[model samples]
Target: MSDINVNHILNQMRSLSLQAAGKPVQETGGSTDFSSLLQQSLASVNETQQRAGRMVDAFESGASNISLAEVMVESQKANVSFQATLQVRNKLVEAYKDVMNMPM
Candidate 1:
């Protein structure tokens, strides 16, 4: 098999991160809500995981024409996305704690 392009994947992820960051808040007659953005992101990640699970189930049950390689790749993608989200959450929590502990 040909070698995987790590740089390409990293660049793609960086581009996506930038895009998400640069999204303008909807003018719903109010300020931007970070909670809603976080919820949307978490929902998206959950959907990805659910899709991967469905693909694996279909592949294992032989109920579809999906290949084992495709299932594995999707599974890995879901896992990596979860890990990245978890890392971001960890950093956010750490920052929150630091701020809370700062002297007033």
Candidate 2:
């Protein structure tokens, strides 16, 4: 087996991440609310997960067009997004606890 370029993979992942977020690299200076941003991000993650699942199914059924590396990269993207979402949830919970514990 030949070595895959780590940099290339990372760049591709980053590109997909930006596209998935549904935001341009340069913000238009328009104010975005936390709720909307969060919603958009969650939607993106869900979409990524769904796409990966489909890719896995296709590959498993002996899809000639789907390559193993493509499936793997898609799977990794889903995992990374999920992990980030989990961390965000954890922090939000911690913040709530901290606020509740603060002296009145």
Candidate 3:
């Protein structure tokens, strides 16, 4: 899928979460809440992880006739998504630490 499609999915997830939480939709918004953004990112990462797991299982179980190349591509996609999630988590933690250290 295109990068725009991925971004669209993320935005939809964020909007759903905000609506569920009874928060006003941020129209003409200055900025989004970092924590909500991170949560949506994590959700997407989890989806990728699950898809990878399924691909591996299919390869091992002889249930799917999918090619090795397809399996490998799915695995790589999961790996890259996981690494991206890790980086986002690290940055969020660092930002939190900085905020905590600041004088109130």
The most accurate candidate by TM-score is 2
Please count the clashing residue pairs in each candidate, in the order shown: 0, 0, 0
Per-residue alpha-carbon lDDT of candidate 2 for residues 1-104, written as tens digits (9 for 90 to 100):
77986656655665576776665653424444678758977898899899999999999999999999999999999999999999999999999999999999
Model 1 ranges with Cα > 4 A deviation: 1-31
For all predicted structures, in order, the TM-scores are 0.70, 0.74, 0.62
User: What is the RMSD of candidate 3?
Assistant: 9.7
Superposition TM-score, candidate 2 onto the true structure: 0.74
Q: Give the TM-score of candidate 1.
A: 0.70
What's the true lDDT of residue 34 in model 2?
A: 70
Ranked candidates, highest TM-score first: 2, 1, 3
Q: lDDT at 60 for candidate 2?
A: 100
Q: Residue by residue across 1-104, what tens digits does model 3's lDDT show? A: 64566555666776786696466766523355767766766787788789888988888888668778888998998898898778877997999999999997
Error of 1 at 46 (Å): 0.3
Clashing pairs in 1: none
List the global CA lDDT of all models. 0.80, 0.84, 0.77
Shift of residue 48 alpha carbon in model 3, Å = 0.9
